[model samples]
Target: MIRKTFAAIALCAVISSCKNERRYDRIENAKWLIGRWENDSRAGKLVEEWSTFNDSMIIGSGMFVTGTDTVFSEDLWLEQHGDSLSYFAKVYGQNNSRKVEFKMTSSTKDQMVFENPTHDFPNKIVYRHVQDSLIADVSGVSKGQPKTEHFAMKKK
Candidate 1:
């Protein structure tokens, strides 16, 4: 009887500990990402805009402009789908207008990371808020080699 009681108590303790893990509100945690960010790089002058469209969605856009030409542009969004959230991007001239989606893997007050291993190029995307600057990174393997791109954006 004592052995059974001890086993029951251990199971209860294990369950309670699991329940104590913190649960974060993904959208609320990402509130810091809203705003306009811009930077000048070798690619061109890049401008990224983010805003809250609804309680469950944040919309964003990015463009690279240089010398009277908009070289590239993309639309981005974070939305609650089903019971979870995802990141979506539609590059103006990529994959025939099909939006690529990355499922959010983890998030915190100042950081969010998403991953889609099946994507051809970028399989991971990370966004981080750092001291009035936003740092974004996309990384994956290509041609049997690892590659990454970083965007350092300042709020405007």
Candidate 2:
């Protein structure tokens, strides 16, 4: 009798885990972003062109026009991890690069937002998914200062 009882409990545990299964369906449409995007607006401008085959390796050029004297150039890479999305980028001359990892927090037909926590500046990095759309917004102060920037992307 005790053996049967233990077997039932084990089966229930397995069933519960299966019920909470998740998939990477969000990446199905992400192919639209795999190509390139360009934006040249007064508010913000950017150029990102690349080819990501199978989401394995990605190579691209990125440009950001912020202040009158600041023109930032960088590279981009996208990686797939089960149900999560990730990106790696490098500044033109910065010794260290940045890796952004976050699951698809929220998404819609025309909009999507991915979030990640940070310990450096602001605690949140929100990415907007859209054509000719903004990608990230930086809003945090290091030490009694202001730090905010907006990133936009558009298909070229």
Candidate 3:
């Protein structure tokens, strides 16, 4: 009789522990994500950035931190789709009203690609993140061609 009672107690404890396990947070509630991310080259030139990601969207803007334009007016839009994030960006130009659309090609733990099929692009954008900095390059493109540059900054 004592053995049966102990088994019942063990089963109840196991079930109680399982019920107490908490689920992970939702994607939108990720606080560690909302911030600025900056990237620089070996020569110390700011290449690109993620300015900020908040309210279920990623904002990337032109980098003109130096010169007279410290805050670029143009920004790209990125948001989550399932486990992947998709981007559709415009020049976000001040008074220019120009726009562009880029769709996702692939994504991994440390890399992502965005492209527009109808637009004239050399190739997909490739990013390598190391520590707090992200490196960017374009594959399947020729020399002297313009590729997407990245410098991600998280919101302080």
Task: Kindly list the per-residue Cα lDDT of model 1 for residues 103-149, writing each as its tens digit.
Answer: 99988878899999999779999999998899999999989899999
Best by TM-score: 1
lDDT of 2 at 27: 52
How far in Å is the alpha carbon of 5 misplaced in model 3?
Answer: 28
Q: 123 in model 3: Cα distance from truth in Å?
A: 5.1
Candidate 3: regions farther than 4 A off: 1-34, 39-55, 69-73, 81-84, 92-96, 138-156
Across residues 17-72, which tens digit of lDDT does each residue of candidate 3 receive? Answer: 77444221122332233345554444433434453455456566545454444544
What lDDT is obtained when candidate 3 is compared to the true structure? 0.52
Model 1 poorest 10 in a row by lDDT: 19-28
What C-alpha lDDT does candidate 2 achieve relative to the native structure?
0.60
Ranking by lDDT: 1, 2, 3
lDDT of 2 by residue, 42-127 (tens): 75567777675553444566776665644888776555577666555566556456544433466666544444455445434454
